[model samples]
Target: MVDADQTFVIVGGGLAGARAAETLRAEGFSGRVILIGDERDHPYERPPLSKGYLTGKAERESVFVHEPAWYARSDIELHLGQPVTAVDRSRKTVTLGDGTTIQYDKLLLATGAEPRRLEIPGTELAGVHHLRRLAHADRLQGVLAALGRDNGHLVIAGAGWIGLEVAAAARGYGAEVTVVEPAPTPLHQVVGPELGQVFTDLHARHGVRFHFGARLTGITGQDGMVLAARTDDGEEHPAHAVLAAVGAAPRTALAESAGLALVDREHGGGIAVDASLRTSDPDVYAAGDVAAALHPLFRTRLRVEHWANALNGGPAAARAMLGREVSYDRVPYFFSDQYDLGLEYSGWAPPGSYDQVVLRGDVARREFIAFWLKDRRVLAGMNANVWDVTDTVQALIRSGEPVDPEALADPGTPLDTVLPRA
Candidate 1:
């Protein structure tokens, strides 16, 4: 067995990288752990960037996952503001943008995903923005703060989680918010049309304008600032600022260039891993959004970019590196906070797979729980302001119970009573 004091190099200082380092220390591996990140700041919580932090309700000091002192105290070296340009797999060394090279015994590619940009004419316009990193939020906050003084029109492209949350936040700041989604409803990708309607109604109630099923053609700018956008339908919409939240693709360039086997190239797919999150290369492991793990429950390969997945999978990958193979069974979960509402969802029930849906509360009121049943098995759970249903639905999923549709929709029945104890 190799000595733990040899070396452990982690790329990307996101939640996954930070947690993996912490977990490694806890697992009794005292090694020269080095974390490399392109971002200047230390690892901080990301979910808040679209929620309390964007709304200015949360302070900058509260955003960090741990104080700088924590990493120093734990003996984890942080290489910030330096992007890893290349990896020499033959020699087991990574070269940074500044031409610094470091060798590693065990390498973890925790390189998180990046926000995708629409390839349109006015993409380089001054007012065009994307909300992914802390620097992005800082710039957006500045734009919004300036807009507050004068009623500014904020146009958001793609109505995904970040787009919708930004819409809600901009609206709260009194900016005229418009969300452009190619689909008929927002959240169609995650919750399906039935529940997507629920979200649409919620955003509608908040005075947000929705341009469903409209494709953005190109942005028109004047003097490097955006003025309007042309739609696929040949219609032009005026806008003061534009935000593109279409989606994100994994950052797999480093892994791919180093002769790592990637699942797909067109979509920027990541290193395919087994049950223990070990990549095809035995010495290399991956976790978080960049790693695609085999889903035992879904019986498929999925790369989940959820908060819970990063939190749990990070530690699991580190344990695997320590020669302890532990399979991650935690259901993939994510939460979105939009305009006084909390949306929490667990498990994956890809759209069109479910034949029936069970409603626990009123969707119109924005307080409800939607259970997706595929062949009478609880495949997914979506709740808005009804957080208590998570454990119940998760238990049912774990139990693999063939719950009756009638029992699922019954509000009178206690959720716990319906689910098996333990």
Candidate 2:
């Protein structure tokens, strides 16, 4: 058994790292916990960075998870602006950017993910941005402040959550926004085409131009100023600034160097962790976007890059590191705000596996709930401004009982009515 005062080193200071530290303290672990982060600021909410925070509706201080005093009170030793350069797993020590070494009884990796890059010309040009950190948000905020409702042109690549949120933020600045996505419909991968069509309609109503099925050819700039983005279809559009929201890849360099097993799928690269979020090495624990967790419900490997997952996975990883046998089987849920619409999605639908989809409300009003069914059982469901049934649907899906699609589609039918009594 390890001493209560044993030092615990946590890498990455985002939600995962912060949550792990907080959970450790809450669990009565009075150990020396050192959080190493490359960024200088305290852990802040990242979801708002692409929406309210970026649009200037929220201040930087408002997004911070905890004040400076909270970390001190919690006794979490924070080493800010210091990146971990190397990890000697054999020695059980990590070398920091400044060459400082810290020995750890246990290590929790929550490094998270980084924005994927577009390796074309003009990517390095001025006015090109990616929103992942507070610093990036600050920069974009400064740009919005500078433009000041002057009908500026903002070209954004990718139509994922971040891209759409950025578009909303840019539109709030009164800028002419155009989004380019390679998918046939925005959110095609997540919600499928039927719901994606509804999302597309909402954006179109708000004047967000989408260049669907458009391939990025290159970005071009003249004298350090971004001029336009060229599509593979041989079309060029003028823009004042370009934002690349092409999604993110797991930051697993440190994990790979430590000889951790990684599940390199066709989609991306991420360190592979078991049901309990443990790497091949038993002493090492990983969570958040960096660790690809296996979903027991789907009986397949899945990685969620959502705020809820990051917040919950961190503590779950900490628990595992603390020798607590627990399975991280929480139902995955995520929210996205764009164009005055709030979208809440829960659970998963394996590709083309859902046999039927039930809609609870009118799609034209932009408020509805769509449930995916497999063999008359609820597999997954999404709510658009209809979050009341989130808990009910979550329970029903996890109930492992077959649900009648007809009942789910009937708006007059209450969700609990269909649920089997406990």
Candidate 3:
């Protein structure tokens, strides 16, 4: 069933692709593995780009998924700075940017996502930044430090996780931060309206200003440098630098050009894939942010952009490629560390999907577990500054049994005992 004559080609040298290659070898596949990416750096984890790396708490080497030598040691071909320009699904080949075509028995696309730019003018001005790649973080880390030392102002667009984490890092450097968000509060789409305020207050207490319900209309700059950012409400905020954290768009050009079906825009577009990460063509697979996978639990196509998704999904995809019985139904999960607040969220319960937001533990002290419930069933849970309960919470969600609200809120009550048709 297996042969060394087969070659597995993985595009995109991010965490997902690298992990897939690793899993292929770990799964006892001795076939040739080629990993391609546009970035000059080796595969690296992204979370540090917005968190620890920005704060100077993490070293440059820590961001890498594996040492540069590991790829060579593992006998995996690493092609950094060469992006796969096209995919020929019928021919079973991928063309690199340099026009080199490689034949593959299986192809995994982990092209990941690109940061969305501001449509407004003056974005090209100096001091305008984005934080999606290690290269961006390398530059922004110095920019934040410079701004802090000079007592400069940094205005950020969007109050999403990237924007807020950068805001926290800016404040840690003693730089002024003003966040412009289109929503009424921060992280509205992810955590919902109720929990959004929690982040808003958290950042406010740390001296970060927020301009809610506003869009960037224009940016004013001087001498090829950003001076201020203009809001739709006709207000201008001073800025030495501006970071756009609006969002990221999945990189699906290769998949689309190859005639692979993609999820519709309304369903959060990405390369459409089945539970096993197989695209329209069974030989082709997509993972990480570029894949909109059919989740057995959610019973719908869901695309997760978090690091955990890539970390786990890549291995899952590799197993599937090996013709193993695979079901990629991992719970949607992500974590954030902003200032003193560190949180881990599990399961998917975006706004209207849940009936109510219930809290347990101390809210004022910022040590609590919040749950999103529907018909008394736990859909999702987020524990902020509270450790060691994620396993219990995930168990509750998987049980699919109604949980007693009173018992869930009681500190004396153990969470495992509150489930199963309560």
Global lDDT of each model? 0.85, 0.85, 0.92
Off by over 4 Å in 3: 1-4
lDDT of 3 by residue, 23-73 (tens): 999999988989998999999999999999999999999999999999988
Pairwise TM-score winner, candidates 2 and 3: 3
lDDT tens per residue, model 2, 162-229? 88888777777778878899899988878888778887887778788999999677888889988889
Clashing pairs in 3: none
Instruction: Score residue 123 of candidate 1 by CA lDDT.
Output: 92
Q: Work out the TM-score per prediction.
A: 0.96, 0.96, 0.98
Q: What C-alpha lDDT, on a 0 to 100 scale, does residue 98 get in candidate 3?
A: 91
Give the Cα-based TM-score of candidate 2 against the true structure: 0.96
* TM-score of model 3 vs. true structure: 0.98
- With a 3 Å backbone cut-off (N, CA, C), the pairs that clash in candidate 1 are none
Model 2 vs truth, CA RMSD: 1.9
Instruction: Give the least accurate 10-residue stretch of model 3, judged by summed lDDT.
Output: 413-422
* Per-residue error (Å), model 3, residue 100: 0.8
